[model samples]
Target: MRPTRRRATVQHTPAQQMLGAAEAMLRHALASGIVVPEAVVETVELACTHRRAGGEGELEPPTPALLRRLARAHAELVRLVAPATPRTILLLSHGRRSRLAMLGPVRLVRQMLVAVLVLLAAFVALSTTDYVNGTGGDILNSTGLSLLVNELFFLAAGGLGAAFSALFTAYRYIAEGTYDPKFESSYWLRFILGLMAGLLLPALVPLGADAEAEGISRPLLALLGGFSASVLYRILERLVGAVESLVRADSRELRAARRAADLAQASDRARLERLELVGHLRRLEQQARAGGTPDQLAEDLGRMVGTLLPVAPQDADDASDEHPQPLISPPAR
Candidate 1:
């Protein structure tokens, strides 16, 4: 029979276990560089409450201030333990995902405008061709449509097409996270005005011998008017794209500025932490001087200095003089 082997069990004090778990979670999150510190704090709070209640479910929730401080400390620890590279942060924040989200709508809008313009050009070219004689036989008459029906059909098609195009473009822009209220309003206004202009074009054209001789029937004129409206719609779409690009650029800059501000704040917090560490070391030094065995004094002094001094020359140079020297060069072991 195989000899029974016993599993070794390591024991920890309550405080040690709590701190160890918190530190482990924090380190893991920092190493991954994905989980935010707030998440860790939330987990810690939950764990602490569960533990305090002795597994009886009577634990009280942590106060808001306590949770906030825990989160702040967690973030500080991450920064101190595993600072992220600037390039990494930039890539994560403004890389392919962000760019796609910002510019996708703009591209779609541009394509829609191109399509509209092409359609308008074709319509305009066809309208310019002289197909009817002064006797009167145009595309509309060729189809046997009454004057009112032809005009109404052209107007309805033009208005509907323009409205649908505008709506589609707007929907795309909004979906891509490029929606701006002012721009949206302006675009709609331009679309409506363009539609009106398209409707007025037929009425605006002078009824002269040339118009009649050119073989331009009422339906053809109305179609030309609709084409004109589509042209205006295309122009407006392009303009919206331009404006949206500017807005997106501005938003990116603002986000970058905010990130920079966050980094500066983190640096400030780190500096304050260093100051606190120095103060703590000073107190330890004073206690050691007051009374302790030589060995104890030496150990305590070692720890205090270790906490104050930087592990690397670069760190030492970077460290403020007001702070205590760092403990032994971060132990190479």
Candidate 2:
């Protein structure tokens, strides 16, 4: 008779499986040259030792404490290696939060559709009502309510315009694969700006001037203003520039006139000084013709020199040292 044969089955416990997975991750990190710390590697190796200590068929399950340590080691290893991993895989492994980010583009498109539908429904409701024609007696009974309703109509049109722009923008971003949740806030801010543009454009500008003649209505103009808020902003900027230019032109003319007046004053002052100098010269000539003495002539000439070139206090001593020299050689008299 042939010898009997023995069959052995192998089973891996949870702790062993976890330890194996950690070791596998560590090996991959080392192979990829990810620079994991030695402490982390030692911790992972120590956890792996427990599985190897029990030889084949021994089935020595790890205690809860050992399992926890093993789990921590595995977590650390994954953390070290995650940065080198691709984003798509990281998103998948990280659970719902990351997956939700992946859905941002879709969510934005849905929101755009919903907003458009809401605006359409509001427009339909307004069109079917007598408020559109201003013929509903009870609805228009209160003047305040009438004004409020008109404002609401303009807001709705503005909202519709904003919705249209947001839909197109979201679609463009989605196609480019660069969509992000941060862009949602920008879309909302644009909507608010559009609403303000719609309400303020007609009031600040004369949009209703040719409404009756050109067959255009106030709400239609508001819609256009909201749709092209940038255009309205450009127009307002140009108006401000024109007003500033006008003010500056007036200021420039005033400055020119002031400068001319200053020049005239300076000219008059110079003429008066020249007249005074001429009078002094005439007196000196009269003295000379009257046969004035050398001493008197020297005194008059020194006085004239002192008046024309006044010396500073510090230079007065220097001027005195040179006083012995005759100023004009006694005029050769």
Candidate 3:
């Protein structure tokens, strides 16, 4: 048998951990070309330097104020350069439970959203039970549950699909470490889209002889449409495109206008780039011409040549002769 190895258990004091975190943050800031604040410098100094007191050499422990300043600086730099940096670093640097405690509210809100979605799904399931079993009574009577239950049934199914989609999205982002509280509103929008898709799909794509033969139901189609709203959206987009295609003259005019705008934008961008190149050439020309190293001379010469060369135009219209290509094609009869 191979020799059994024991894992080393190395524990760090709070001060040492804070110092390490500070050092790590400062190193990250330096690597990212961010400015290190004075507080971080002080914290580093206090943590590293030993002072002689009572003839004993001991590190000048970092003060609370210094640590607080360091924490703020670290947080600011982390937010600017790498927002996805784990909260454990902040917790370590701050030496406080409250650093992670702030996320409690966000967690609670997500849980509440998930709970509401679950309830909605359960309610929808119960509401459709009789209908699915082919023992349905009047689905559109005057009672509160039946006033518009026929439409509400499909809409709720769609909402349930949206909820599942949202949950899946949240799971993906959380697993990938890219979840942010700021994008919660987008999930709400998705839910609304799901509801719309759920309601509209039944009307747009009817289940006739083929669907009955295949055992497809209207509500089931609505749920599927809600679950894949993007596909439903593409279907609607294609319908709109086909309608637009029927009016060839109007479509051609729209295309021409869009092309003209794009060409104008390209022309403006090219003019700005040329001006910038001219400015760079002028600055390089103004720099000292004497006693420069060979590497510096070569770099300057290369830049000058690069700035002076004629750049190929990005647009075909810009590169072609003065008689430009027609922006619009003749509308087909």
Alpha-carbon lDDT, every model? 0.54, 0.68, 0.63
Name the lDDT value of residue 118 in candidate 3.
70
lDDT of 2 by residue, 1-333 (tens): 998988765576766666666776677678768898787787777765766787765757777877777788878876876643322222223323444454332656566677777877876776665555432212224356565566666677877887778777866754443455556788878878888877666555553345557766657766877777886798789999999888776777889999999999999988998898888888889999999998998898888768778557977777888776767756555
25-86 in candidate 1: lDDT tens per residue? 45445555745556556666665664576654333445566556555554554464344322
Candidate 3 per-residue C-alpha lDDT over 125-228 given as tens digits, one digit per residue, 9 for 90 to 100: 66755443322222332345433554667787777777678777766665443566668788778878888988778667745557756877767766887777
Native-to-model Cα distance after best TM-score fit, residue 108 in candidate 1, in Å: 18
TM-score of each model, in listed order: 0.26, 0.43, 0.43
Candidates sorted by lDDT, descending order? Answer: 2, 3, 1
The stretch of ten residues in a row with the least summed lDDT in candidate 1 is 85-94
Residue 275 of model 3 has an lDDT of 91
Higher-lDDT candidate of 2 and 3? 2
Better of 1 and 3 by lDDT: 3
Give the TM-score (vs. native) of candidate 3.
Answer: 0.43
Error of 2 at 293 (Å): 46
